[model samples]
Target: MRPLTEEETRIFFEKLVKYIGENIKILIDRPDGPYCFRLNKERVFYVSEEIMKKAGNVARENLVSLGTCMGKFTKSKKFRLHVTALDYLAPYAQGKMWLKPSAEQQFLYGHNVMKSGLGRISESVDRYQGVILYSMNDLPLGFGTAAKSTSDCRHSDPGTIVCFHQSDIGEYIRSEDTLT
Candidate 1:
């Protein structure tokens, strides 16, 4: 697949926001890492297939509290998750993050701590702020990163407010020049 044009990425995000709702919480993985989430209603939802598929809308609305924004579910038009306004859980501690396009980028690795027993061992969607599509011939120097022992660390794309742990390279189509 070829790299997505800026318009294409924007359209994709618009569709996601429409389908998932603005206030909905989203957890997702990066191209090659763990997971992260966005419980804050004001934050832009980061959609990665790896994390979204794992959780698959296990949580919803008020009770939904927290769950991974698996890309498998959100990236696809077929995913129909329960859409309801989110009431941020004080205990979980939520906030909104932002993102934009740039030449350089970074990724982090970590897991969600919103569930019982699991303690959010599995990565979720809070990580990603957004995507930065570059010309097919200009890929970011280190768009990808690795986890330190996989103990759940917060990864942030300094350029963009978006952050994620796991890497979801499959989500984006790469071309020879795009990342070069």
Candidate 2:
């Protein structure tokens, strides 16, 4: 377990604040102790469970990994906010793409969504920007990138609306269900 270097800390904060917000700065002040850093790939850092605990009640048991992995990002490797972190994030993040239960089933299976499948969407999501995917009842399902801008998703009849579902709670449940 290695501590984050001063430079790494700065990079982490800059990247995280971009995805999340300035609010996350408070939690990473020291970037040591319970919080540990490991880089699985250059420019891709993984933060430990103890670090996540400081963010409030992150639901780690439902997650496959305790580490919150974030990348500097490219089209294929977009920024990811783990399901464990969603507990502390849903209230603060701006865009949530809410989906119906039926749509959620396919989505959990890694299917991209069409505009018709969205129950509701946030006000100003831009194309290619990441979004929080929410259940119809407002629970955070996971994270995704907007396949189309909010306007296009709202008005277009046949465009795909959310491309990569970065993570989802139902997918975890389904994976567990399969093991039995």
Candidate 3:
């Protein structure tokens, strides 16, 4: 792990901020030594310190975080809401996709939602971008990667529209101590 210089943090943040919007209250808690980007100091993203520092300039950078980790730290690490970083910019979020009740079940089960499953979405969203998946009631379900462009996701026939959820509120109790 390394630390992010002020410059690396700026570039990394600029790209993501566009998806979220300039108004979202994101702060770099500590870009160096275990990178932490926080939304209002509550929801936090823990990505690698090195990756944050090394990138001179990268666009549409995947907001990968601790949840994306797949090793021993998986259990100990908390699920970070990389997508919800744009929640504050909900009004301006271009990559939002809402699902029907049936689709919500599949999404929570770690299945990709096909285009038909999408009940609503924003048109400005691009392909392979981070998107927020919402329940029928408009409650944020979690975040995912767009499998197709927003236009394609809307009318591109039956196919995966959103990637498997990367992080959700449910993850708080998962891979760790549970009510059980």
| lDDT of residue 128 for candidate 2 | 66
Q: Write the per-residue lDDT of candidate 3 for residues 1-180, one digit (tens) a residue.
A: 223345544555555554565534443343344544322112234345555444323432333333122111123333333333434434445578888887887777667778778888877777777677788788887677777776666557766555556655455445344211
CA-lDDT, candidates in order: 0.27, 0.60, 0.55
Top-scoring candidate (TM-score): 2
The residue-level lDDT of candidate 1 at 80 comes to 21
TM-score of 1: 0.18
Give the per-residue lDDT digits (tens) of candidate 2, residues 70-131. 43334454444445555555666766789877788777777787776788888887776667
Q: What is the Cα-based TM-score of model 2?
A: 0.63
Displacement of residue 37 (Cα, Å) in model 2 is 5.7
Clashing residue pairs, backbone N/CA/C < 3 A, model 3:
none
Local error of candidate 3 at residue 87 (angstroms): 6.2
Better by TM-score, candidate 3 or 1: 3
Q: What is the TM-score of each candidate against the true structure?
A: 0.18, 0.63, 0.56
